[model samples]
Target: MEFSSRARQRHLRLAGDRREPYPHSLQFYQEPPTESISLAEFESFAALAEDDYDARRKDHISHFILRLAYCQSEELRRWFLQQEMDLFRYRFHELTDSLRQKFLDHVNLSFEAVSALLSGFVLRRVCLMLFKIVGLSDAVDLFRARRVFIKDGFAFVPLKDIDAIVLNNYRKNLSKALALTARSLPSIQSDERLQPLLNHLSHSYVGPDYSVQKNTGKISLEHIDALSVKSFPLCMRQLHKALRENHHLRHGGRMQYGLFLKGIGLTLEQALEFWKKEFIKGKVDADKFDKGYAYSIRHNYGKEGKRTDYTPYSCMKIIMSNPPSQGDYHGCPFRHSDPELLKQKLQSYKVPPSGVTQVRHNLFGALFNEALFLNFISY
Candidate 1:
């Protein structure tokens, strides 16, 4: 009855009306099969061995179905392509050794001899396909740099060079695609049947929940000076340094850093005293501090007004939201600080230039990876 009706709707949504044969050919690629497949059937097939008869049939068919849904937007298409590439890699890995060799030979991938020693051979191949727009100048540069082979004015980028180029291209496309997706999300989400899946696909967790107060009362104000030097995140460390040096923090800085201190176990009384002493050293008198700022500190600790126990900002939250203005020491250093200034700051802290570069690279990679994971759950 109701269940059957719902099932039928789902089938139609996934498999199409089934009146015409599902066109297996997608734009730009003609590798998929010509058969039609329902969403449920595609899922089952994708989960089976590649050698399975039905799985082979459905593999090619399922891609076209996904293409139909994903072709609505560039973001969706890129995500779909990446996911299909991942699936292809997995399936390729699962093939027999002989079959693997045969597949490589069929693809005319001579570099397989070099890449077999390294993992991600399949991924490298897929990424190469995604990043085929390498310009002639760039190809010539890569050739001159001995990083790629050039034949007949075409540069064949090596496996080692693939990651950087692929990641850069992915970043550019993904950023634009995300902006486009956000603009178009309202229309895309209008369909009740598609909204849940679309929302799920877009949802991503940046890191662990900072709202959970597992470390409450674990830190003491007496040790904060020492802890700030050693255990604090870069953002918090910068705030602490600014506070110690200037003896005053702007409202934004106070809120951002105070909440973090509260999360790390600064009592309401300790926080008040800390801020009071720091402010008094500057232009603010003790009386002004009590009148203007004490309530806010208390409020942050759930002792005033709404008594809401606000959580500390997570790294993602700090990075993505409410960026600090000029004269503010709060906000993510990675996001807020000027790059050259940040490098100088890091060097002043005794980090070597190479280490600074590595840190920057790692942070960028993490941010990009998180963005990719959240924006496209299928990948």
Candidate 2:
């Protein structure tokens, strides 16, 4: 995105209180850009200079470029899919009734309003396009809810619900397109120029890294146990409990918990001492613990091998990663644990029985405040 000279003429410019300009487009959307956007955007918006590249062509080309870049991994694919779907939903809702029809026509999705089905009560609305004829099984929710009229083996969706049908169709097509793109990776990866760019796109982190903790090493070992009660996140609390009770965690648990602790403030020396003491208290003596476990903790802090400092896994990463196995305590409880098991864990934590409804649909997105999350679940 570019701005014209008139942007400086605007009273409120596109810049944050931090005096920072909005970054590239993806980061621009990922973070709140009110401070940085309005000024620069309006400035750019005002100056439709002759030299400016074609905005429509840029938007179209940019999406295809991203498709190639983001189709490399499951995480990237899902992220792209979600962003595109959200954009579609927003744009669709913004369209006027006539504009919406035009867009549908533009996309070659011919949808006729089913208001013509009945006479007198409602009639004569139907026209050029036919209603999206979906299999009875495909529109089961609409069928069950009695939202759409069924004829023979097809479901006739009304104009209001046609967007949902069209949206699903786009999702399926886009997903298949991504899959087909992925299949071409062998040839694509050999293109030295594109490979590096695609690799970067797949692994890009949008916001602040939890690295360079301001309070690093300020947190003492003794305080960790206290922190677990209410301060630690749900998964971290569970991992801490398991580590203490068993005096050992399998590789997955250790990686997850160890990085989290490092992110919080545990320094290299403290981390080594913390693990050594705990492991010795169990079956592993000091020597065995040093041999088996010491390297991993150091590696996490960028001490060994290639020594690339690793960031702690985000909640999203943990959610997307492999499901934890039995005797493993790495994954999010709301996500990985059985429903009954999750409820029991909440009960064990003394969460009110009445507040356990959030577990019903395995929804964890709204789980910021534990008490309120439980309350929401009950709803």
Candidate 1 local lDDT, 230-314, one digit each (tens): 5666678789999989999998888889988888787777888888988899899988988999999988888899999888876
lDDT, each prediction: 0.59, 0.67
- Stretches of model 2 off by over 4 angstroms after superposition: 1-59, 73-79, 86-102, 120-149, 158-163, 183-191, 212-214, 222-250, 272-379
lDDT of 2: 0.67
Output the worst ten-in-a-row residue range by lDDT, candidate 1. Answer: 19-28
For residue 295, model 1's alpha carbon misses the true position, in angstroms, by 1.0
TM-score of each: 0.54, 0.54
Clashing pairs in 1: none
User: How many clashes in candidate 2?
Assistant: 3
